[model samples]
Structure formats: C-alpha cells, structure tokens
Target: MKKKSTHLRALEGKSKSEKKKIRKEFEEVKERLEKAQAKYVQKPKRQKATTSKAENKKWEQKRKDRYNQRVWKGWRDKDMEEYPVKTYNIKDIEKDT
Candidate 1:
C-alpha cells in the first residue's frame, strides 16, 4: 500500500467539524482563483460590419454634400477668397475734370 502524505495524514487526524471548515475554506479559495483568472483572460475582438460598394458610394456622396453645406455653404474653392474692390474718390474725380 502507498504511504499517505503528511498533509493528508494531518487532515485525517482532524475532527468532522474541522474537516468541514477546511473544505469550505478550500472551496472559497478555489472560487477566488477562478474569478481572478476570468478577470485577466482576454476576450475576442468584435468584427466590423462590411458595407457594399454602392452603399459606400452613397455614404461618400452624402458626406460630401453635408461637408459642402456646412463648411462652404455651396460656394466653390475659387469663390471663398476675400477680394479687394476698387473704390472711386469723388474729390479726385472733380479735380481731374
């Protein structure tokens, strides 16, 4: 027959109440270890939904329209600059006449 381990021998020497207490404590420690492992385990990444070419083109056009309306107010790039207007002086025109 195989000899019992010192730890097992010690546990065998304990009363029923002591054994029950030890078992309960062991269960609590096991539960804690499982919870810690679950907390540290890496979860799988979620996949993004793929859009069709027509859907992408429609979204792109909508985005462009919104950007043009919000940022440029339907004006083109060339019309957005601040140009200086030529003003005529009345005194200078009379003196010249």
Candidate 2:
C-alpha cells in the first residue's frame, strides 16, 4: 500500500496530535514529489511538426534531386526519349564527385 494510504489508515482511533503528525508526513511526501516532477520539462508534442526534422530533410533532398533532374533535361527540346528521372539516376551523378 502507498504511504498516503498507510498514513490515512493510521489515523483511525489516534489522538489529535498523532493525526496532525501523519498529516505533516503526507505534506512532506507531497512536497518531495512536486520537487522531483519540477526537475524535468515536458517536450513539445510531435503533432506540431507532423514530420521529424531528419525526415523533412530527407524528403526535401529527394524533392530537390527530382526537380534538378527535370531541370537538367532540356524541357523545351521536344525529345521524349524518357522522363528525366528515369533516364538519369541522381545518386550516380553524385557518386562521380
């Protein structure tokens, strides 16, 4: 049983002084608990940032590479050999450097 419950049960048939002593002990336990809880700050909810930073960074890199592939293709020249991304792999170009 919890200290609070034990202390509460102790109150039955006790003198007024003893009841006051148990109540004081309960207050001390409450204070110690408050102190322990105050040591840690709560983190912000993930819902605020739907995606984590690393995931966002990875997605942005992929999107940039995709757009870059399209930009590399001469969009104006009407030669449809294949889509830019399918024709050239981004990682292959990066590996050269």
Best candidate, lDDT? 2
lDDT of 1 by residue, 1-97 (tens): 9999654665787899998887788779989999999998999989886898899999999999897666664344557644333478999999999
TM-score, cand. 2: 0.36
**Residues 20-42, model 2: lDDT tens digits:** 99899899999999999988968
TM-scores vs. true structure, each candidate = 0.43, 0.36
lDDT score of residue 58 within candidate 2: 100
Give the lowest summed-lDDT range of ten residues in model 1.
76-85
Which residue runs of candidate 1 sit more than 4 Å off their true CA positions?
1-10, 52-97
- Candidate 1 lDDT for residue 4: 96
Give each model's whole-structure lDDT: 0.78, 0.82
